[model samples]
Target: MPPYVPRPIVVDYEEACRIRDLSPKASATLSRRCLQGMIRDFHGVREGTLAKEIEKIKDKIDPVTWDSIEAVRKIGNIGAHMEKDINVIVDVEPEEAGLLIGLIESLIEDWYIARQQRAERHAAIQALAAQKEAARKAGPTQGAGAAQPNP
Candidate 1:
């Protein structure tokens, strides 16, 4: 995970990874919570359930990415919410949990890391533009061997 990610999100994601093999359900739940935190923190969509929050950002993201986010939400939902019949146990396979974790990794890269990179690039462009503008304002310099104009 990138160092810029918030500590709480990193903690949840790390915990999810730690238990993915031993307890897929717990891992999925943690991943789901981590996803929700990302949505709320990054996208500024904090008004409703994870599903609704995802819906709010549907247009903001590409269809494929939106679908992937929805998939994570559904799989994580299995661990988060109980079935109507309490006797039934719907298990999330280790592989599925791993996929959720992978999606989170992608999102962190797509959203946070990409945003930081974009900011840096923009700042660089702005700095160069300022340098050019300052140079233009300073007027053209005379060659060292050029003759001087009389006052």
Candidate 2:
């Protein structure tokens, strides 16, 4: 499949990917921030540290997804803390950072885009069903004139 594009926070995710090669730490930081934002925006997880917020939303998501999110959280924790002290060093390979970026993209799609698409599809199906029900009640439009011949 093509690259995953999250409808929300697309720029932040994209920027994280863009900076992956140059600075894995920065990329991971961005990915972590994106996850925090997603939890707050989508799940209404507004309180506590990111780890705690994840706990609040964890049960709602599947085990596998939650695991992946936690992995990103771990990487992000290291990246975020390194900024506080010069002696605190966390090593994250480029590929590891990329994985976090990938996770963020998937979360965006799974959490936001897919839900939106499902809602739209449900609305369309309901409309069609309503139309069909109306047609059935109308009883084939009696006396609307005979079938027209093709010219």
What TM-score quantifies how close candidate 2 is to the native fold?
A: 0.82
Please give, for residues 46-96, the per-residue lDDT of candidate 2 as tens digits: 877998998898789999999988888888878787557687677888998
Indicate the TM-score of model 1.
Answer: 0.89
Runs in model 2 lying further than 4 Å from the true structure: 1-8, 83-88, 142-151
The number of residue pairs in model 1 that clash at the backbone is: 0
Candidate of highest TM-score: 1
Give all TM-scores, in the order shown. Answer: 0.89, 0.82
lDDT of each: 0.93, 0.82
lDDT of 1 by residue, 87-135 (tens): 9899999998999999999999999999999999999999999998997
lDDT of 1 at 109: 91
Model 1 steric clash pairs: none
Among residues 3 or more apart in sequence or in different chains, the pairs in candidate 2 whose N, CA or C atoms overlap within 3 Å are none
